[model samples]
Target chain A: MENLLDKKQSIIESALELVHANGFHGCPVSQVAKNAGVAAGTIYTYFENKEDLIVGIYDYVAEKITSYIAERDDDSLEFENRFFNYWRNFTEFYEQHPAIHGFYDQFLNSPFNSEKVQNRPNMWHEWAHMFFQSGMDEGAIRATNPVILSILVNTNITSTVRIKKNFKTKLAKTNVNLDEISQLIWAGIKTA
Target chain B: MENLLDKKQSIIESALELVHANGFHGCPVSQVAKNAGVAAGTIYTYFENKEDLIVGIYDYVAEKITSYIAERDDDSLEFENRFFNYWRNFTEFYEQHPAIHGFYDQFLNSPFNSEKVQNRPNMWHEWAHMFFQSGMDEGAIRATNPVILSILVNTNITSTVRIKKNFKTKLAKTNVNLDEISQLIWAGIKTA
Candidate 1:
């Protein structure tokens, strides 16, 4: 059973590669199976269909990221410090695995946008929301709606990922530091 | 030449219909042409290829939206009133066109994010930046970085669009009125 789960996950990650490279509509399942070093039947065994495969990748990654963040002792640190570390770790992790960025944006714009995929108990949404609310209560972060604040932070990080992955290094040449991107957000939302 | 331009635009509009209906990559030039009531060869005369056709539609739609906001007279109104009118008008305009929304999110998320979009002197960007700066000057909005404020507005507007279109009516059931969303954003930036 464990081996079957591993094989299924491997196939899904491989599908992410093809999906991001070509596009949601451009990639084929046969190639995804080939890339995963699995058979097409194995792909079907894991996912009911291509749509399920696409959203499954998102859920899988979201769960992993949230779990990682939740395990951290962020409460020991200052609010900004905790958020900074989380943002750095989150962005770096996704940057290393560019395919995840592809799926994240894809899920947002896809029909899955309409699908309510058990997001509440999910580590990503719930934990992040609490973290921001904690910051707000501690007077470290602005008293703006923490939910909206969290949303802003997520958009900044992910949109930067989207922008950086999409364009050439033109912004870098113009001294557009990516770190400042977060700091700018942090500054705007800070209670100083 | 005038007749050709009208026919070409109609073809592109038809392409938008097909692309929106069947995701971008799912639709082909031949299908677009057939839907447009034009010959496949005629499409090639107007567009270089599928990517080009997609790009053309985006440029057309983006420019139209920007121009609508641009042609408005907000100069005489007070800042708050002006901002509200612009926000209301922008949302109304955006809500009217699902194709534009589809094309936009797909375009933003795709590797086509930059595409040297000839950015239409986006009044919205300029307005927000100025709003931040002027508010700080007048001792109204906070002393934070205007750039981040711009991002907050973006997060608010885009997420609102994302939810409004994607999330069905459940979002409103929670009591996050558009007016309150606007106020939450305004309060975040406003001076105490």
Candidate 2:
């Protein structure tokens, strides 16, 4: 059973890397199975079909990323520290996993996303909502819809991360200051 | 010549609508031609193939959206009014054309975008950079890289517009005030 679980996870990671590099349609199950060094039939034993395999990868990756973000939370810290820390942690995580970051944007824009979003259990969003709610209650953040606030903060971080990825070498050479971006985002969401 | 131009444009528009509805892979060149009421041969005259058609639709749509935003700009107005006006106009435009908005997210996430971004002329970004530069010079906007400022503001608008599209009816019933969201973004980049 442990070996079976390992095979399943390896299949998911292989598929994720392929999908990141070649896109959804371009990456086939056979290629994913081969990349994982498992027989093509083995994938069927785990996932129902190609659609199932793709969706499985989505859920698996989401869980992993959400766990990373959730684990960064420090309940002992104040709201601002907790919030910015999570944001910084998320940026670092995605920056480290650039392929996953690329796959994420692809998955978000895919048609399958809406279906997954409607049906999937999203702890990440829940955690974010709770954090925003706590901040509002503490009078640290504005009294806006938690969802809106979450989206704003998340977008800014992701956008900055994306910009960093797009021109990392040039940006490094130029010494572009991304530190200010976080402060700007915090300014947007913080209470007056 | 005039007739040819109309036919070419109609074909592009049809391709956009179909691609927006069904996605790039789901919508084939034949289907686009069928939807546009044009012969498959006609598409070849306007575009090299399916790949070209999809990329062409991206450039066309970008031009239209940029024109809408650019048209909203009043040179005489102060930076704040100009910024808000462009935001409101962009929101209204994308709200009315949700399909185009959906297609836009897809296009942005697609590999084709990076290729296009590298090779294509971006009048919109240039215009936005100029606007931010003027605002900075006027002491109305914070001193930062104009590209960073543009990305921050643009990301917020698109994120809000995405949320609005995702849950319009429920959000409408809840009376979620997105107007304040705009003010928050403005506050982030504005200088007192």
Candidate 3:
């Protein structure tokens, strides 16, 4: 059973790397299987089809991110400290796994992310909602819609990561301090 | 000359629709030519190759967005009103042209957005910088990196649009007020 799980995990990782390099249509199931060092039939054993494999990649990334953040999360910490911790953990996860960003950038816009797919329960979004809701409950954050707050904060992190990755040299030359993004978001959402 | 320009525009429009519907790998130059009602050879007259056509789409969308916002911009208004106006105009543009959102989501992540490609000057970014800088000049907004501000503001608009489009029914059911996003951003960036 453990060996079977490992093979499934390996397939997910391989598919992510290939899809990141080449868009969905470019990375067919055969290519994914070759890259995973598994028989094409093995892929079907794990996923229903190519579309299933793509959705599996999203689930894999989402779980990885949520687990990383959840491990670092200290509910006992002050709300502001917790906020920054979440920000740092989220950014570091993407920086370490740059392919995840690429995958999301393509996946979210692709046809695979249909209404049915998006409406499916997502772990990462649920984690974000609970985090923001806790802050509001404690009167540390503004008493606005948690969904909106999550969107505002999460988008900032993802966009920052995207820009930093895309314009590494250009950003280094300029005084574009990324920390200010967190500070601004904190200021905007914190209870005045 | 005008007729020739119209042909070029039609080709671009058709390609955008095709690319949005089908990812870059799925949309071939031949299909684009057919959709545009032009000869396959005619696409070459305006664009050098598939790669050139993809870049042309980016340029086309950028120009359309910047021009739309620019035409609605009223510099004479107070900075805050100008800020909201920019936000409203930007959101409305995407809402009207949902395909632009789809194109960006794919293009920005695809191999097409190479460093050499991204390094190309973009009118939209420049306009955003100037707009934010003007706010700082008037002592209305915080004195932070304009690039960061642009990322934060623009990402919020795009994300909100994406969510609204993707989760139309869910958003309507929840208290996910979209306007709160702009207000929160303003609260975060405006001078205390």
TM-score of chain A of each: 0.86, 0.90, 0.93
- Among residues 3 or more apart in sequence or in different chains, the pairs in candidate 2 whose N, CA or C atoms overlap within 3 Å are none
RMSD of each: 5.7, 2.5, 3.1
Candidate 2, residues A64-148: lDDT per residue as tens digits? 7788988878877889998889888989988998777878778776776755454566776777888888898888877877876
Query: How does model 2 fare in lDDT?
Result: 0.78
Stretches of model 3 off by over 4 angstroms after superposition: A25-31, A136-145, B25-31, B136-145, B190-192
Of candidate 3 chain A, the 10-residue stretch with the lowest lDDT total is: A169-178
- Candidate 3 structure quality by residue, lDDT tens digits, A23-80: 6756878888888889899999999988888899999998998999999999999899
How does chain B score by TM in each prediction? 0.76, 0.90, 0.93
Model number with the top lDDT: 3
Worst 10 residues of 2 chain B by lDDT: B167-176
Which CAPRI tier for candidate 1? Answer: incorrect
Full-model lDDT, candidate 1? 0.69
Model 2, docking class: acceptable
Best by DockQ: 2
Tell me how far the alpha carbon of residue A156 in candidate 3 is from the true structure, in angstroms, after superposition: 1.3
Model 1 clashing residue pairs (backbone)? none
Tens digits of per-residue lDDT, candidate 2, B97-168, equal 887887887777677675546456777778888988899888887777787677767777777888877767
Check candidate 3 and list the clashing pairs. Answer: none
